[model samples]
Target: MITKGRVTATLDGDFVVFMIGFRLNKIWAIHKWLPVFLAMPKMLKELNSNKDLGYLHHEIWFGRTLILVQYWRSKEKLLAYAKNKDAQHLPAWKAFNQSIGSEGSVGIWHETYQATRGTYENIYVNMPSFGLGKAGKLQFVGKGQNNAQQRFEKNE
Candidate 1:
């Protein structure tokens, strides 16, 4: 399933930190790969269906490890999908645990934060060799507009 959400807060300047995760079941080593192929189309469909949800950022590392970073307008919208029992997410979570929970064939994890009290900045540079470079710089807002402007200028 496509992990979806919005940015709650910016942290450490570059990190547009939010909560996201997905679950996948283990397939027989021989046939396991088949599910991924079958699932891709469905997953992609769901993602496209929620196009207006938020800014979706994700990366699949080493194939199995899925990482998603997104910015959302509020936590309510994020939680609504997560709590949807009939959605693809709920069934997928069950299947993953049943098939891979024991052998560690499948697993899912997520972290959520309430972003408050910080100024955040980020840069995304796409390079041919590197694909994408991401950075987050954050600091406390102090004094007034003058201080914030100075910090922002320094960062630029």
Candidate 2:
């Protein structure tokens, strides 16, 4: 059994939050889609095992389109992982380019947010751990911390 309640989260210092995922433009093209799907676990496994790479953690959403929200210690660290030749990401990326060159069988995208302390605020009420909640430190909301603005002030 699970209980639901209020839980808030905020991170410390400068950090990078990355949102990346893909969409299946053509549901019938399993060959094209499966490789893209297969590539993620390899990269995620590599990141999860090596914390120094600044891969903090992630939450994923799956559907016709998939989304992954990832936190990192810094932008430099995140870029390093993306560019490192020895890593799983680089190979998988090259394969993606080769196999699916914008033919529209699949679509992929990403957005990155570079943040510093006090730049973001979040709240989770009657919910499980999620988003910045999973990526940041969790704390119970208290007096004057019941809404968005207060959460920013309380977290700061």
Candidate number achieving the greatest lDDT relative to the actual structure: 2
Q: How far in Å is the alpha carbon of 133 misplaced in model 1?
A: 12
Which pairs in model 2 have colliding backbones?
Answer: none
Q: What would the per-residue lDDT of candidate 1 be over residues 38-62, giving only the tens digit for each residue?
A: 4434544565587454323434444
Residue-by-residue lDDT tens digits, candidate 2, 28-66: 999998999999999999999989899988999999999
lDDT of each prediction vs. the true structure?
Answer: 0.43, 0.87
All candidates: CA RMSD (Å): 9.2, 1.5
Residue 8 lDDT in candidate 2: 80
Candidate 1 local distance difference test against the native: 0.43
What are the models' TM-scores?
Answer: 0.50, 0.93
Off by over 4 Å in 2: 1-3
